[model samples]
Target: MSTGRARRALWRWLPPWALDAGLVALAVLDAWINLYDEGTPLIWSCVALGSAALFLRRRFPLTVFLLTLPMTLFMDVAVAPITALYTLAASTRNRPLLAGCVLLNAAASTLAWPLSDGFAGDQTWTLIQFVYTLATATAPVLFGQLVQARHDVALQLVEVEEAREHERALHAQTVLARERAQLAREMHDVVSHQVSLIAVQAGALQVAAKDPDAREAARTIRTLSVNTLDELRHMVTLLRASGGKETELTPQPTLADLQQLIANSGIETTLTGGLPPGISTTAQRTVYRTVQEALTNVRKHAPGARAEVRLWHDAQHFGVTVTNTAPTRPSVALPSARHGLIGLGERAELLDGTLTAEPTPQGGYRTELRAPTRPA
Candidate 1:
């Protein structure tokens, strides 16, 4: 097996033209050795035509084999006829035509060139010679057919591999769709119900509270809970639609919603600057999320802090910066997975952008997002 592979590798390194030239040289040498003695002008001419015809064997195998037959009848030259017959056998699928070609080659080799010389032979000896030549001619044909079968099997294996890969991809997509549907059901049935209760309870507290501070805090809690429910509903809708069915989705937040977001944040925030008019919807959403996450973090970690949201854009880039003052009061620690900034960073990377979050020298915190104006 290793030796056959090495031989095939070597053959592949040789160019097609070089292989054809080598075959032509081998056929010419065979004709020269056979017809060296008993050489006439007519016989030499036949040898020249037969040897040259081998160059076109791959393109016109049957014609080249017929050209070599004339020389075979006049002289004992095997290389040209055998090579031509093998090429024809490998190229054609017609078994009857291949058998006819084998018979013609054998007849040409068995009979003498002149009609009188062939007739003068002993009939039994002539029949024996024909049988031997017929058997010899079939060797190249059988080998050629074997090579052709190996090539066909290699192509079939490649097609089978591609089909398996396609099936695997389809299976993965089906599994992902099923998981998304299950998640949508849980969010709608569990999370939405709890947040709705929180909103209702806060509204009732705001109506009944006698102290102004207590009433104001209850109103803020009610507003935040309602906003959370709206976002949760949108997420559930998207997850359920992951199966590729067209469903109307709630309009996503954009730059126009930035002011309302800051107002309802329950933190003192200032908004300034603006983005260009033609920016894509995806970029707008990225900017909105940046400010939203930054403000939420300030509220959680920097209690009683004032935040400033600045949106800026030039010819090349556009982004938002949310800076917060140091907290006036200590904050209550909240459970967090710390995946918010990581998700924001990934989102920015998808649009060829960057996100930076760090503490300021004066004990404040800053979060900024920068993205290309025209994403590829």
Candidate 2:
């Protein structure tokens, strides 16, 4: 249906022997037509030469064009000579050579007609020969050029489509990578907070237990929880690697502009402390994330519980806490991934900090975060 596919099919279906036989038959038919129309052996011999050249045109196009030129002067209207010129023009685009052949055909036809018998050197007869030569000799070459142009455009279109397909595939791969890295970060947050909480609760149990066996079991639980959290962090680090967010945070929010964060959070929160200047950007970012997660947890687990946010700085570390009073009525279950605190703990660890979350004895929740003021 399409030119490229059709050409491929033609190549597959036609053997060289069959194709050569077809071209030879076409040349003979053209030679016979000239022979019948002229009925002159001299003119017919010249026309036959042009037809015979057809078989070699594919291998020697310019030779075919030159060889067939003298024959155009022999016959008044020859198809074989025109076909030779067409094949040459279509195959090779040597403009000056083709122009010379066309001009020679016109000049020879116009001038040689007078040399024929029954010609009284009439200007009108010469004019008719010129028009016929120009039309018959040049028309086939023009048609060949048109076919060549169309073929070039078709090839160019195919190349452009292939380039676009390659670009699309690369774009898809980039998007998939970004999504995977984002998923790793989210998983890290959930896993770390939950595991850290397990460690903390077990630690408290170990401290309060009186039985030696109970204390030892509690200690084992805490150790396992901490060890598991360590392994999870290592796995997440590998997964998030090469995605720049693995090493440095973007859209970093700091404590200086934290009031806006608190106001927009839709929670009644207070800020009482500020960090002194010269704190590293990384630690400040960790502080910002810790506070945000704390407020988020307060809103989730203690709905309608008036919350208080406190911040303080010592020579070694800066501390943040979000504490809420006991809820009047039990908070309704909200759709939650409950991974916010895990992410928070990891963020604190990045800054040599600790995140502790627990139930207050008064039936409320408290989340505390501490990060080093100086690099460790």
TM-score for each candidate, following the candidate numbering: 0.57, 0.48
Candidate 1's TM-score reads 0.57
> Across residues 84-184, which tens digit of lDDT does each residue of candidate 2 receive?
67777787667787777777767665665336642557878878878878777788788878877777667555545543453454345345546656777
**Which pairs, if any, clash in model 1?**
none
User: What's model 1's lDDT at 256?
Assistant: 89
The numbered model that scores best in TM-score is 1
Candidate 2, superposed: residue stretches over 4 Å from native: 1-45, 93-98, 113-128, 193-215, 226-376
Worst 10 residues of 1 by lDDT: 240-249
Give the Cα lDDT of each candidate: 0.83, 0.69
lDDT of candidate 1 over 1-376, digit per residue (tens): 9999999999999987888888889988898888777789888888888888888888999999999998899988889899999999999888999999999999999989895798798989999999999998999999899988888777556545543553454355445656777898899899999999999999999999999999999999999999999999888756643432223465777788989999999899999999888887667877887887788788767868899999999999998999999998555444455556755675577568999999998789999999888842
Candidate 2: lDDT of 182?
76
How high a TM-score does candidate 2 get? Answer: 0.48
